[model samples]
Target: MRNLAEKPYVREEQREVQTVRRQIRKTFTRAEKGLLTLIGAAIVFSAILMVSNYASMYTQNQEISQLQNDISQQQQYNEGLEHQVSELSDPERILNIAEENGMELNEDNVRVLQP
Candidate 1:
């Protein structure tokens, strides 16, 4: 402050203005902006994919359950058919069917075939 304008300062006489200084500057161009947008879109897409996967898994489980129920019903139906077959063991049904086709029950009238 003595004579800054009248005399020149020495090289080591100048004092430091600040102990530390920090500054941050950010700049965005069209390409950088587009990159940020793409990143955001990718995050959203990932979320959608996760939701879709969960939905597919849930639907598959439901389908499996329905198929198991269908199998149980079909098994019951087959068992009922088997029971009916066991009950119809009388020879009268066969004789009636044979007579309807004009087939006689005589020993010579029957043809024997073996496989």
Candidate 2:
């Protein structure tokens, strides 16, 4: 039969052992905590750097696309100007303009220039 009124006697040695066990249960040492903090900071920094690089690359790609569009438009404009030049430089158009301005063409005095 157990006596319920009497409290269990805990020895000082046992108490000390229990305290040690509680201390042992602590998950991380100070150095391990510092290392974990450093690792976490590094991961955050890497993420930020990667985002920054991606943004920069995206901006550059957009700029390149705009430049390509501009170049294509300019090329089309240049082709238009070239067509106009070719049309305006036709010998018949030139002769018509000259005759409208009361100029006579002398084939004997005309010289053709070769490129």
Candidate 3:
């Protein structure tokens, strides 16, 4: 490696001097100024885009929370339905419904016919 003192300075300090010596002024024409304005607008637009992206994420998170709540309610509903089905599956309840529907239980030795 070269010594630190041997390293040449890549950055020039007197940018004004270089411009003056080269007779190149940093003057902006109307179109150039408008282009710079457009670049600034693009930067602001990107910031708005970042904020809107986060906002949409927040909205989706809220939706997911609501869906989770709905799922919990559905689980409770399913549990209630399971309890009702269990209650209705008792032998007495089955015989009651069958009698109401005009059906009879078949004995092992009985032969049944349908029309």
Pick the TM-score winner.
2
Each candidate structure's TM-score, on Cα atoms with residue i matched to residue i, is 0.56, 0.75, 0.54
Tell me model 1's lDDT, rounded to 2 decimals. 0.89
Model 3: per-residue Cα lDDT over 25-107, one tens digit each: 78999999999999999999999999999999999999999999999999999999999999988978988898899988877
Residue 59, candidate 1: alpha-carbon lDDT: 100
Cα-based lDDT at residue 68, candidate 3 = 100
RMSD of each: 10.5, 10.2, 14.0
For model 2, residues 10-107, the per-residue Cα lDDT tens digits are: 67564343434344465899999999999999999999999999999999999999999999999999999999999999999999999999999998
TM-score of 1: 0.56
lDDT of each: 0.89, 0.94, 0.91
Tell me which of candidates 1 and 3 scores higher on TM-score: 1
Error of 2 at 13 (Å): 33
Off by over 4 Å in 1: 1-18, 90-115
